[model samples]
Target: MSVTDEPLLSVDGLQTSFYTEEGEVKAVNDVSYQIDRGERFAVVGESGAGKSVTSLSLMRLIDDPGRVKGGDVTFRSTSAVATLARKFPEGVATENSPGYIHVTELRSESGAVGSDPGATVRDNPTDVATSLHDGSLHIEAGHVDVLDASEDAMRELRGNEIAMIFQDPHTALNPVYTVGEQIAEAIRKHLEMDDGAAKERAIEMLERVGIPDAEERYSDYPHEFSGGMQQRAVIAIALSCDPALIVADEPTTALDVTIEAQILDLLKELSNEEDVAVQLITHDLGVVAELCDSVMVMYAGKPVERSSVEELYYEPKHPYTVGLMSSIPRIGDDRERLDTVPGTMPDLVQLPSGCSFHPRCPYAEDACLEHEPPLVDVETGEPVEDPDPAVHSAACLEYTGELQDGVDFDVQIREDAATDGGESV
Candidate 1:
């Protein structure tokens, strides 16, 4: 497969926990997914669902008391591949055509093949071997284990390859510095450009993110701008280095509806134009419906359901997912009260015995209280130990045929509601 065909990010069996005074709290548990290049993915759930924690873990920003205990986070590094080619040009040979190279052919002066001199190719074939394809110079380098990388390595990776858009713009931006200066600092530090060049790039970023009169706003402080403007500034900084993937943790929090819509649109536009992948974390299903191609519904630190936006909205399998969809306020619905999932999120430190969501799951039975159901394919009802990131799956006993009643829900998509911009559930 071409480099573009491989997943940009692969997270497997990710387990992040916090060493709290109360006890060890499992903030993120066995969460796994993948993000393809230029793909828009969403992580949706209520507060304390581990959505933010998961993002922080991926970014290696989890502070004191919290630890990413287990799992593998593999990321494709184009810069690493480029560095390899520069360091060992003799080892890289053209394969079929111009953008294709056989990395295994790399050999040192000693005629030894590998990343290091005097090492056989068999020693580190997969870890050091790179690939080129698609006629676009898309270098598919060996995967970098983010969790295992050193602090210095992480510093190099952050903001350059992977960037983050924090939840609150006010808190994210520094009050002491001009917003333009902050963006310029990141650009200069990563791209090694002079101050004037970085400033020009920063102004370009601000304008690209739709700031009005970008050149004039270059000197404006964070407090001088409105909430929406501050958010735009934050986005500009996040996009300053032209990162390959951006982990946006609720980019539209606390904004007015119009501003939120604009921010979402800007993200979509940038992702399309820049070919950057996006991993959006939000509690709002509306945002997911508006922007994301695929959705992973997390609950109490684990994904309970995973599918495309259309499939999840139209044919939900897990009861928790059903409850979430049911709770959305439909414009044409006549019900006085919107449906709500019963009970709050379980305490992470002392999560219940079997399934973490069994207490709140409407279809929970005795089996659910005794055994946690594995995530399984919705159609085949077979346990998926290693699920394809894009496939539809859910972690509920109903899929396993253990629940006697079997979970069922109807999604009524009104024919005329589409034209009127109304919703039905």
Candidate 2:
């Protein structure tokens, strides 16, 4: 499917922090990216890179200590009318007006403009009100700034419009409830289907996710399913509501190689078949290569590199991204040990003075240690205040003409690159 004119999800200058007695740990700082409809975007980095925290902040799942300090997350919803009706029951009128009103024009009871019960969203006609029902207004589409949405509005959107597939299925799934019942519960709540209808839809979703004997497995609990099956069940629940975006946080991390491939294939198939956008968070570059079209490499809670998968793999601009690509094992490797990025991520509370990765960077220079670099366009080599998702950019002193001897790297291609030479990691 072609990408829509408007992006499905747009995040700008997102800053999330965790307050502790020691100090405030900036888990996600100035993270921004966009996901178009049916686009598969990958966020890859080492453990403390704020990949998961970024996703959590987007979902508004951050707790008290860990709050989203600043940022804007705008989402385009498919079922805006129903969601808004449920969110603002009092605003609904019995009068059947067959006129279209832009979502931004329809104010809540508090007279606040936007879909939120109390918050605000930008004025845009992307979402148009279609008609008014017995006690609800029907909207064809809508845009919502989730940050401004109230808790109740967020609850209506969470399972209904945006769904998350957590890393561990064991914790995501309710151990006491049957897998089918869990899926049915989400269908009933978000979809407003009856008991029988929800149960049938749940079984269908189970089958769609590749569960064997879904009918028989309906009554089975989480313990009854294997690791892979449990993960599939979680996927079924996430897909039950047909969310526009699915944030899969290391969905295959806990499964074995064989099962991991199955899960990856399933996700790829579902994303294409369902035409659902995906925000895949994983540390594995191999998985990113297989499933993602666009890639963002995050380091120290910031996007160090952003580009198409092919461009990122062939011509990585940032040293950190180059190091990550170099660490991946190739098909014909004779080295005793694989190359690894030196040193761990720095403490977020007290980051390095200049470039956070300067201490571990191989080509670091005096300029790199003295000044931080903004994301620069790869072609123009100019700094970008607000990056465009489609543009290839990297955060490196070399990009900004600060490094004396610039970072050097090359992608070697063998003569017989098709069969065995140009194998992806």
Candidate 3:
């Protein structure tokens, strides 16, 4: 699962919503995107723009009331799980080479053990301790609808294949467990590693993630470490199995700026060297510009613009996107005020009739308030071509010939407030 030129994961028509006492809040609507092997795809938006929810939805980690309304999250694999799974005999994970059995790969279909994707098990392999942490039960999900993948498959798939670096390390890392213990537990669960070996590997991973005094500090509780160190430890846990994809949801949220820079550097380095694709969910456009290869601008739970990082920054086509760009402070630039989108993001429960962003968009008109524009290429106003990395798509009425007064991208320097008041003596 190193580097390949194929799309490792594709999400289509994803709809996620939260049910409240008042009404259903659609957090993600018709979201679709894909990340190729080793690509760093970023999802950027304001606080409630559904960046985090989209990531959670991809991982099937969304909790109750926040159900996946409709979608397909297909994972492409080349029989890796099945191949390694064959090494297990009667559910007992073999002591020798089993490529990597992330979370007990209890055979999916025609359950059997062998070093082949087509190997059939004598029976549903659950009775094998590999099947359960218990002997009385069995678990398996019959489909790839990640939201509904069997509890066993998901448990293994999580840390084994797709791992997540959550926003807060404090809540993410168990307070009661020793830092090393948690990492070792994950390693043991996903890999065919014994206790002693798993502990050693955990220490190694901790060191690999740049934690200092790794061996000695393994016994320390989460509270014992500094903020940066805790975050490093969390990264260690996520990388324990060398997952193919990592969903980093504001991984730098709590850290100081310096620490945040270090974390981002580490993630970028890992993605480049290890060929691990990252789904970075963030509110910082600067971070997106710096770290992401491609960027998706989410607004009101829908993707309004998507393009390679360069196009998104310099050739932005969406009005909301342009406003966001004008908000970024430039070096050695003198401006009285930064551009801001007026009004707040809409309420998802009662999202505006047409385009949710119409209320805040400067270019919006009656058509924008009545008919929502689909995500289309800014130049052609057509569906985006998969191979065109330069395709800049935005959901804006201006591109669709519906916005009477389109966006004005001209530079308008306002008079300095104090200066406009009159000369002072």
Candidate 4:
């Protein structure tokens, strides 16, 4: 499968929650998306918007207080398509003077564009064919229902087929083990290689990731490496098995600007070279525009908007998305005060009855405070409604028919002030 082909991973109606001592907190509510092979998809939001937790949920890595309460995640293996073209020798000089030689050459000499030469390609074409015969898989490219697989099934899919790089490299890397040993361990576990082979592969991966003296550095501890080097090592571990998909959660948060740019470039290069889909989770919309093909904007545990990188940065639809775009400082913008999205994020334990963002949105209406808005299609100035499903979908009452002309923010401020015991606004 190629990047232009249909998505290999699909998620639908994902609802994740945490059973905390305080109460159950719904972290992710009704999240859905599809990630095609070799695509760089991004999940962007403020803290507590469930971006990190969503990545964890996809890998079934949630533990302790957190659990995937509901939803489905389907993963398919993709590969390069190889078409065999056979050529026979025109005149046989040897043999019985009538011998035929079959010269099998790959079609499209530019390297079999859409073929799956890797074992990580999991989209079972055989199963698909059998299902078509007996009716099992039954789902079309875009219409496939998200799969509700068991833990064991998901475990088999994770790491080998899908791998995740956490936000903090310091914490993600094992301080006690040598960087080489850890990478080798991951390779051995996922690739099923012996210790020696895994070590060799680990050194290769280290060198591929631009580590200095890869062989010697393999025995180096995590603390011995700089922030950028640690990040590269983590990426090496993530790509050890050549996973079909990689979920990177804020991989550049701790690095300096120069290091951050390098890491981003490295990730982009790896994604292209390995032909692996990447799910980049971060709060930096700038990074999203730089790295992601499509972007999902989440707020208060729900996706407020989802659109392509250009559409999101240019013609943003959701109010929240617009606020975020405006919040980014431009080079020439010189105003006394920078615009900020008013009001703090709500308490997840006890969210508002209606639109969660209504309390903070400047354009929010009275109806927004009374009823929750359903994410739906809306006709704008154009004669025809936008058919791009991924363009823009917002959970805001303003998009709906119900509109309240003017609503005072005084009530909300008073309530918040009282909640904080008359603290300064």
Candidate 5:
């Protein structure tokens, strides 16, 4: 698992939603991004902005009523090819290694992707390995939609290949189990180590995460540890396996500034030492400024902008991003009240027809109210269904010059607090 130039993870046209008594609530709209091996990618947005949901969807942790409707989550791995080879002992005929697996695990019941008439994946050997034979997937470069894998395969993939750190360490941890026991459980289950070895490794991980007196603390229950200590334990469990990708859902939100810094620094260290990729989900742009290589801004469940962290903060192109920056307090600000977007996030179930943020955008015009703009390169502003995730892009009519009276980002900034460290936010 050495880091390579090729992308380790790529998500395309991802859409996840919840089915309610009223209707389908699009929690995560057509979001797409790709992260390279060992990269720290940040997804920033206010609460209910689908930041957490996106991560949860990637982990396939969406509970009943919430389903990942449309999307492909591809992860590069040679081991995954072996996993597929084992899963499709009879049906799949792979020419190349399964270098990438679409971890979503498309179910055989998800219609065409897995249950095709010619390639139906059935329990019996007589059945076609239809799950891996998605007409399009030849398994070259190991790119196979994981949505086609079985639950058993997905289980093996979770802690071993992909891991997650929840927002609240207390809730994520089992109250009845000791901190070390839980870590050992994960180790034993994923790594298949014996109890004695697993416990020893768990202690080693605890110490690695800066836990003091690791052996003694191994017997301490979750309630016994302080808030910061609990978070450290969570990180210990997450990193114990050295997963290829770790989706950290606001990992530092519950900690104090000092602890937050320590946790962030620890994550940075692990990213380098372990060569693990991280998808850091948080609303704090300051944290993104500190830890991430690239940033994606989400609004009302849709990606409004994405770019390198410097470009995102220093030269934001979307109006929503500008509004978010205006809300952040700067040192020389003279305004009596803090700047905030005029309106709150729209109700997901009853989202406006066109651009969801049009109501709150000062530059919004008739066109914006009628037709939502696709995310596009700010320089070209040409409408693109799926813009390059690595390039600077935004979803706004102004980018395409549709709005005659386009947004003047200057209006959102004060004279002295205009840029952050000479960057645009």
Candidate 6:
């Protein structure tokens, strides 16, 4: 899709929570973004930063205690609307289709029954057509929202339109079934091929992912294959349906450095070859810089900053982003102490009253504790030359002009006064 075009998937105000025995844990909170066709989007954060939850919400795969509270996920197709209209007419509707909405016309037998008489017949048609054309028709294309679709409809779209490669290949793959059988099952289910054809296709996919002796290894169990092989098998299964979008949730987490590099290369190659958009979820900044077109730095279940991978690595905006970048160990640095972000993640059940990261942020002031800062355009008001208004954003009181003139050094003063016989500054 072109730069001016609507995103293939757009998520707005997404909130997901789980009702635990202790309390409701907000896994994801009002997270939003847009993914263009064939773009590599990465969600980078520490573990439990809601990266996986976001992906699960997109697939409607959250179950049991987890539930989506509020959100709008809108998906736009790259294919022309005329083509989709041809395949499925304006008035036509399918019961099992996830994003299918029907438009009904009421024909009055008598002209006397005129409701909203001032409105022209053309106006009503236009409104209804617009709603049908753009408002409701959404199917999740990977992490993108396919709108107006029910659970059943989403199931149909899941593997066919959007596929996922989970973090753990061993658990994700069926232990009892042969590797070939599992792949063939996915192929048969999504591709609607017969048993023989599905098996053949499965073998072809294994070969495509660089699994040696594909035909021989198809019948091997999950335990029989090595970690790298299992991961490759999982990739083969995820790509079997030729989905438009793929969610790789730390696909390299379980592998060695060499294997991880190989897997990353493989994914990159597949993304280019198949023209499929990828969402890579990981905490590794190096991986984000290497593979992602755009990077979203999340903290406390919220995106603290977002920018192009290059900009984010080279010129981070938020203090949290800067801290994360600084935490990355250098190859030849001989410093006694490596820089580290202070404090642990706050309890999601009872988050801080104001900015969630304020407790850990060294630059935080009293204003940060008074109220949460809104994510906004930094350049319009500030005299400082900010690059790419849309590309960078930070949710911090320091950037929002709410910071106090002087730093609040209460903790440092207390420590100093206790250690030395000096009055607190």
Steric overlap count per candidate: 1, 1, 5, 11, 15, 6
CA lDDT of each prediction against the hidden true structure: 0.80, 0.80, 0.75, 0.67, 0.78, 0.69
Can you give the TM-score per candidate against the true fold? 0.88, 0.87, 0.82, 0.76, 0.85, 0.79
Candidate 3 runs further than 4 Å off: 1-5, 79-145, 385-390, 411-425
Local accuracy of candidate 3 as per-residue lDDT tens digits, 156-214 = 67887889999999999999999999999999988879999999999999898788889
- For model 1, where is the 10-residue window of minimal lDDT? 96-105
Worst 10 residues of 6 by lDDT: 135-144
Q: What would the per-residue lDDT of candidate 5 be over residues 224-269, giving only the tens digit for each residue? A: 9999999999999998887888889999999999999999999999
Model 1 residue 407 CA deviation (Å) reads 1.1
* CA RMSD, predictions in order: 5.8, 5.8, 8.7, 12.5, 7.2, 10.1
lDDT of 2 by residue, 153-267 (tens): 7787787788999999999999999999999999999888999999999999999988989999999999999999999999999999988899999999999988888888887
lDDT of 4 by residue, 76-139 (tens): 4422111000011121112223221111111222333132211111222232211123422221
Q: For candidate 5, what is the TM-score?
A: 0.85
State candidate 1's TM-score.
Answer: 0.88
Q: What's the C-alpha lDDT at position 183 in model 1?
A: 96
lDDT of 5: 0.78
Ranking by TM-score: 1, 2, 5, 3, 6, 4
